[model samples]
Every structure is written in structure tokens, then in C-alpha cells.
Target: MTAAERIARDFTLLLPPGWARIPLDGRVPLRVKNLVTERVADVPVEQRETLRAALTRELTAVLESAARQGGLDVLLSVAPVAGQPVPASGLVTHLAGQGNGDALDSLVGTLAAGSGTSSVREIGVVEVAAGPAVRRLTTRRERVDGQGDLPGGVLTVTQVDYFVPLPGTRDLLVLTFTTPIEQLAPPLVQLFDVMGGSLRWVTR
Candidate 1:
């Protein structure tokens, strides 16, 4: 099997009850899941389909852009919890920056310390489905001054990075969960943790 296909099979998002999965067409299908009521009476299927279509449009652009840059492939998902105002989105990316562990670490450190970021704290080592991974926590605030659409003017963004080694390959499987801090709740956080922890490499 090809490397991208092999990496794709390594893990899956284990959606809790009331969640439904939607697959978006890309070079590969992007698997997406969202909190949905079992009964059609709760939220009409048409309404949900409309939302899914919109999300697919946005994700397609993001993934396609990433593809233009070498060594990055992604699987994207969207999950909207019951009470939360903003839904959670995820990206599991395979990036081959510098093509080595040490180079990847240095690149992450550089981004963490870069100008726009508020702070990038070292998370050190952690384990994922594939093997040991280096983690980092980064903080940034969105500004409305010259940006696209934001009436409120600012939103705090938090991103947790996991650099997982793809055995016998120079590429790194990057598991990243980025969400606005204020909108993040325990349940959503747990979802990210569970998905990241379940990552494991599959060999043919």
C-alpha cells in the first residue's frame, strides 16, 4: 500500500452515541462526524445536510492548499457537541519537514518561538498509537483589525501538537487539535485526547 493510505488506516475517530459520520471527497475521502440526534424530528436531515455541505467546501480548500506544499497530507473532521456554541474541528496531518526527527523538533521549536504566536510551551514526550511523540502547546489570538470576519475583534486559539514517528520513513505523523480556548469544554477536550491516543501504525 502507499504511505498515505497506510497512515490513514492507523486510527479512527470513535464517535460517541448521537454522532453521525460524513465523508467528504478529496484526493481521498475526508471522514467527518458531528453530534446528531437519532430521531429525524430533532433536527431535519435537510438542515444537517446544508451544514455539512458548507463545512465540506471550507475543508476542501484547506486540504487542497496543504497538498500544494510538499510532504503534507491530511484527514479532517468536524464535531459539534450538544451545548457548545462553536463546533470542534480536527486535522491529522502527515508532514515530512526536514525528513528527520531532529529537524522536525527544531522546526516546531522555531514556530513556537515565532513572532505572531503568543507562546509555545514545551509538552515534552508522550505516547500515541504509533510510538513516542513530542508534544507542544501553542497559543495565539485572532485579531479583527485587518482580518476577514470577526465582529468581536479577538479570539484566543490554542493548539496542541503531537509529532508521531512513522517507522521506516522520514515523515512525521502530526496530530494537531486546535480550538478556541474559551469555547473548549471538557468533553471536547476528551474527544481530542481519545483520538490522539488511539493512533497506531498499521503495516501490511
Candidate 2:
């Protein structure tokens, strides 16, 4: 049997409580509305509708942006991780190739050398439940001026990307974790590390 035939085409991830997978379908608006409603359920009834409307609009925009960036699924977290309340999010994407670890390493090297506002904080191979994977941490300073409802300022976003190579294939499944909460980066990164370690390949 060929390598592709011997390997699984699917994988699974374990997300903690309060982390939700946003569907990238035509019904995204509806899903956002439902999520907004649930999130504002504790607000005063008199101001619930207004708050819901505002949150729905904002969240819809975020999800739409994720889709435009080739994200398969956008995961949003609003609860505590590692015993601290830290709001963060993630995106899953795939890259198809025809090489092996050497190819992945070359790709990583290219990424590390790319010029941008973002800087690579760390890059190395880490063993997870699925096997060896390349982990890269980066931070970018984004200007929030004229960017939707965000206030005018430089927003520092911390991101961690895991490039997991499929067994017997050059293709990779990438998990990207990001957060604008720079003050809580250490714990948030730890949470991302745990999440990445939980990834498991599913067999046919």
C-alpha cells in the first residue's frame, strides 16, 4: 500500500472548556448570533439586545477575517486556561507539499528569514502525541488605527505555530495560536503548548 493509503486523513484536537470552534460556512452569521446571545445572557435584560448586536457584529468580522486568511476553523477562547482568565484564539490551516522532514525544515528556515513586522521568538522541533512537529513562536506589532472598532494604538500579538507533518507524506497540518493579550502571553502560550500536544491523528 502507498504511504497516503496507510496514513490517516483526519486528526483530532482536544480543546478546553470555553473554547469554541467557529464554523466557516454560510451560516456563520447565525452561529455568531447564537454565540453572542449566550455570551450576553448574564447582562441586564434592558441592555442585552444592544450588547448582543454589537458583539455579533464584531465577532462576525473576526470570523470573516479568519476565513479570508485560509483558516479551516477559527477557535475562540473566552475562559480561563491554566487557572487564569485569558482570552485567546487560534486558526487551523493546511499546506500540501511533496517532501519530508527536510522539506519542512527548509520551509521553516524560509519563514524564519522572512522580513516583516513580526519577529520569530522561538523555533524548534517538539514531540507531541502525533509525533515530531516544528513549533515557532512569533510576535507582531499591528497598528490598530483605522482598523474597525479598535482604538488607535500598536497592538502586540503573540502567536505560536505548530507545523505537524503527516506520516509518510510531505503535507502538513498547521495549528496557529494567537492572542492580543500580551500581558498574559506566558500562560496563554503554555495553554497553546498543551493544546498542541493533545493533537492526535485519526486512522481510517
Candidate 3:
């Protein structure tokens, strides 16, 4: 390829997964698709390469920065009861004697007679304490498939899982890193150990 060809081709080289070439509204307008879940967002022509490059550089820098300040992201999802905690069924019952009593009373009486009234009124109320707080780790290595932190030829991500405190709370944390599978060695272990040591009373 000649110089001009090389320059033109460089327009789309080394883009991360999930990013596709897109037409833009301005001069030299092109964008990469976000490779993981969503397609790479539209770039403002001037920022595509900058954003991608920054994603590469900033991911490592951010992780290192976070390590210095302490804490990484943890995702802990909890599925609560499917319905609303407070049902409005009894609200109508309690206010049955109020202004619009006749219709509400009639509806309640009919429903009660049917023996299929909202049992939600009787379900035990258990207010779960505020759970953990996990933040999204802004990763510089934006592409899922490319760029890893592997060093010394030993991959051990599956062999590891970790939890951290939510900054200033006792609530536990869970999160995943954008770092490469092979790269989670000392720092990963260290973070896990530190959190584990601090929470030995709560966690076994």
C-alpha cells in the first residue's frame, strides 16, 4: 500500500470489538462500534480515534489510580420479591368510610366474597437493609477481545473472585475488572486479601 492508501486504511485499523464503521454528519466522520453489548457510539469525527486511544491508555491508568486510592468495582445483584412492598388494597379498605365509600366498599365486598382478594395485604413485610454499592469501573481497555494485561504467562481469572467494601460502609461488594484474565496476579490477590481481612467477622 502506498502512503495515501496506508493513511486511508488507518482510518479503521485496530478498532475494538462491537464497533463498526459508521457514516457521520461531518468531515472525516467515522466511528467504531462498541464491541461488547452496544455498538461503539457515534463519534464526532474528531474524537473517534482520540476516544479509542484514550480508552486504551486510560483503562490501565484508572485501574492503577483506583488501586492507589483503594477499591475496584463489584457487581452484586439481588432479586427481591416480585411485587411492590406496600399494596394499596388495604388503603381502600381503611378509607372505605371516607368520601367515595360506596364504590370502594362494594368492590372490596365483592372481592372478599370471591375469596381471591389481594393476599399482598397479608404477606410478611421484610425490609431488606440497603445492600452493597458497586460502581462501574471505567476501563481504558474498551474493547473486550483485544488488549490484555498478561505478564509472565500465567492466566488465573477463573481461579479468583473478590469482594471489597463500599468505600465507607460494612456492606460487601462484588465487581469484575476489565484487566486481562492472565494479568490478575498480585494486585488482584492483594485487593481480595485486604477486603477479606477487614471483613473476617462478616465473611468466613
Candidate 4:
């Protein structure tokens, strides 16, 4: 059997309460509508619709952007996790093996070195529930165009990435947690670390 076939065809991870898993599919709009409805339910009846529509549009845009970036799934937290208000998000993407058998460390090193203007905060092998994986943290400034009353400027985005290699293959499942809320980065990253520790491989 091929290495990929011998291992699991997919994997799973644990997300804290209030986290929503959004798959890239035809039902994205429907799913976003549901999420917006639930989140804006507490708003005044007259304002709820307006709020819902705005949120739905913004979220749909984010999900579509992630899909175009090769993300397999997007995990978004609209509520607080563990009593702290964290609106962080995550993206799951896959990196297929080159078949030339490059080592995981070498692959990670190459990725870290290609971060362009982003600063690599940390990179090392870390032990988690799944096994040893490469953990990389980075921060970069991203420009945001002004919209409505919001002024356009650059925002610092912090990201924590876990590169878990599938057993018997050089393929990697990448879990990337990101947040633009720089003030709350510490707690957000701590939550992300716990979530990363909960990753598991599912055998076919």
C-alpha cells in the first residue's frame, strides 16, 4: 500500500466551546447565515437584521479568502473561550509530500525562511497528543483598506502554526491559529497551544 493509504485519510482536533468549523463547500452561505443569526439574536429586533446582514457579509468574505488561500477548513470563534473574549480564528491546510522524501525539519526550515516581511517569533519541535511536531509562531503587518467609518491602516497579525507529519509519509497537516488582536495575543496563543495539543490522527 502507498504510505498515504497506509495512514489515515483525515484527522481531527478539539476546539474550545464557541468555535465553529466551516468547511469549504457549496453550503458556505447557508452556514454563515446560521452563525450570524445565532450571534445577533440578542440584538434588538429592528437592529438584529441589519447586524446579521453585515456580519454575514464580513464572515463570508473571510471564509472565501481562506478558501482561495488553499485552506481546507476554517475554525472561527465568535464568542469567548474559557471566560476570556477571544475572537481568534484558525485555518487547516495540507502540504502533500514531494515524493522525494524531504525531512520534516528541512521542510519547516524552508517555510520559516520564506516568511518575507513576517518575523519568525519561534520555531521548534514540540510534543503534543499526536506526536512530535514543528511549532512556529510569527507576526506580520497586514494592511487593511478603509471601509465605511473604519480607517485604513496596518494591523499586526500573530500566528501560531503546528506542522504535524502523517505517519509513514512526509505529508503534513498544518493547523494555523491567527489573530489580529495584538493586545490579547498572549491568552489567544495559550488557547491555541491547548487546541494544538488536542490534535489526533484518524485511521481509515
- The candidate that wins on lDDT is 4
lDDT of 3 at 9: 19
lDDT by residue for model 4 over 13-62, one digit each (tens)? 78787888887778988899888888887889989888788888889899
**Order of candidate numbers by lDDT, starting with the best:** 4, 2, 1, 3
lDDT digits (tens) for residues 1-204 of candidate 2: 235423422677788788887757678888887888788888899999897888888788889899898666788875445666456888887666733665657766766887266889998778889887888999999877665775587778999988888876787778899888788899889999999888889976
Where does candidate 3 have its weakest 10-residue lDDT segment?
Answer: 86-95
TM, every model = 0.63, 0.81, 0.20, 0.84
Query: Candidate 1 on 1-204: residue-level lDDT in tens?
Result: 466536644555454544333322343333322222222235566686666666556655655565554323343333434643344555556665333544555655555566364666455666666667677666677864644563556777777667776666676777666677546635656676677777766555
Off by over 4 Å in 4: 1-9, 80-85, 98-102
- State model 4's lDDT: 0.81
lDDT values for all models:
0.56, 0.78, 0.27, 0.81
- Pick by lDDT: 1 or 4, better one: 4
Best TM-score among the predictions, by candidate number: 4
Q: Cα lDDT for residue 176, model 1? A: 68
lDDT of 3 by residue, 110-139 (tens): 433443321212111111122221222121
Please estimate how well model 3 matches the true structure, expressed as its whole-model Cα lDDT: 0.27
The number of clashing residue pairs in each candidate reads 2, 0, 15, 0
| Residue 123, candidate 1: alpha-carbon lDDT | 58
